[model samples]
Target: MSWTERQRALLGAMGLRVWGETAPEHALATSDAGLEDAAAPASPSDPDPAPPRPAAPERRRAPAPQADAASPPPRASPAIDLGAVAAMEWPALREAVAACRACDLCQTRTQTVFGVGHARAHWMVVGEAPGEQEDRQGEPFVGAAGQLLDRMLAALQLSRADDGDAASRVYIANTLKCRPPRNRNPSAEELHACEPFLVRQIELLRPRIILAMGRFAVQALLRSDEPVGKLRGRVHRYQGVPLVVTYHPAYLLRNLPDKARAWEDLCLAAGVAEAAAEAAG
Candidate 1:
């Protein structure tokens, strides 16, 4: 789409340049002038007349064919059954993920990131999907974004890996097991195909608090299309677990100012975890 001044400013904020970019000329045109006017109908009395045509060549028409009753109808393909995957335990679930080919992403992915950290931690960190480093390392959040996430977790006295203490342990996983080609956004079908694995993980862990990072992660978990800015600063729930939305670490890296807002989200999540513990006690 053609970028407006406001859109250009937004792109600048995200550290992007709009100059020399190829975009549709009239993409940002928010007027109906180009559209056909429904109110003004064409009148039969209009002055324009049809032009005369020269002599045309004649051709024979083909006969209509009848349906063949002898031919059998084509059978429909069977749908992928997620029921078996949902019923699997941790080991079986990991195996299922390794062998999962329900989506096209499987063909491009080097390996499925089955997630790391404590299996039954009280806090769960969910990201959108795997990146290049993550896919290569077979772990989620492994690059600069992952480093930022580590610092954030350290600030909260939480560790994705087992730090020899159960209370400080936190589980980290992504919305999709496999990364999309070129790290593009995961399609609706891909998410749908991989959702059972995520759902099963949540069910098995039953984390008291879930921190959803990025717009896609929040959208998948909450089933809402609202932007992360709108969804943040408030606690939501997922399958009875307290869920909080926040900017992804990769987003925070580009928009440094939003890191403060992410910190706020983390604090809110911690509060929820404490309350849950007190209620349990």
Candidate 2:
């Protein structure tokens, strides 16, 4: 299919080579652009949480104190009420995330990084976790990496911060609400604690497509430990929602060649979203 002026601009912004009369069709996708090398894991202070992986640098904060195995598990003060959180409206849900102390991260995070975007968007971008910038700003997809993500989404004609058409809008959230301290691997416990908020958010937003970015987010959503390269170019499901997987923008920044692949994933997602919208219509 021919590209639109907007499509050309979107691909241009993402630094993808425009294929004049060389393209096929457009599609949809979602993601969390973090600040780090994609090959190595890095922590972030403002954006999506950097996964605990081999090595790299990001918005690193001092590691949180690890609980002693001999000591009794830390008691969650005012434990999160899963049922209550699931039943909350947007206002109540926001407050629950803000006050949540269900995991050790609550102690280190400056503030909880709740999601942002159109409440009823058809597309949802789910990242790994909160980063330094994300924690401080109380928003996801900030900083340079976020800029890249915006470009990617623009290629698909979507935005997380817009009052544009609902079908063109996006809602971005993270698998983990708070940053996993330093480079420490986020525990299964931490993921379990935060799952409710994301689950409820999905239920509330009822997005048509979900873009899972980063190893952790992909793992959490798809329940797979496969490398992103193996998982790309295919459709997955999260709670029956059509999901597309791609590398985090942070990874793309370091591995420039992958931009083309990311664009392909975006195109795949766009096609899926378009098909879904048509069916619903």
Candidate with the greatest TM-score versus the true structure: 2
Tens digits of lDDT, candidate 1, 35-69: 22212333478453222222222322223323677
Deviation from native of the Cα of residue 146 in model 2, angstroms: 0.5
lDDT of 2 by residue, 102-135 (tens): 7788878888889999998999988888777888
Q: Which candidate is the best by lDDT?
A: 2
Clashes of 1: 0
The per-model lDDT (C-alpha) reads 0.73, 0.75
Candidate 1, lDDT over the whole model:
0.73
Q: Please give the clash total of every predicted structure, in order.
A: 0, 17
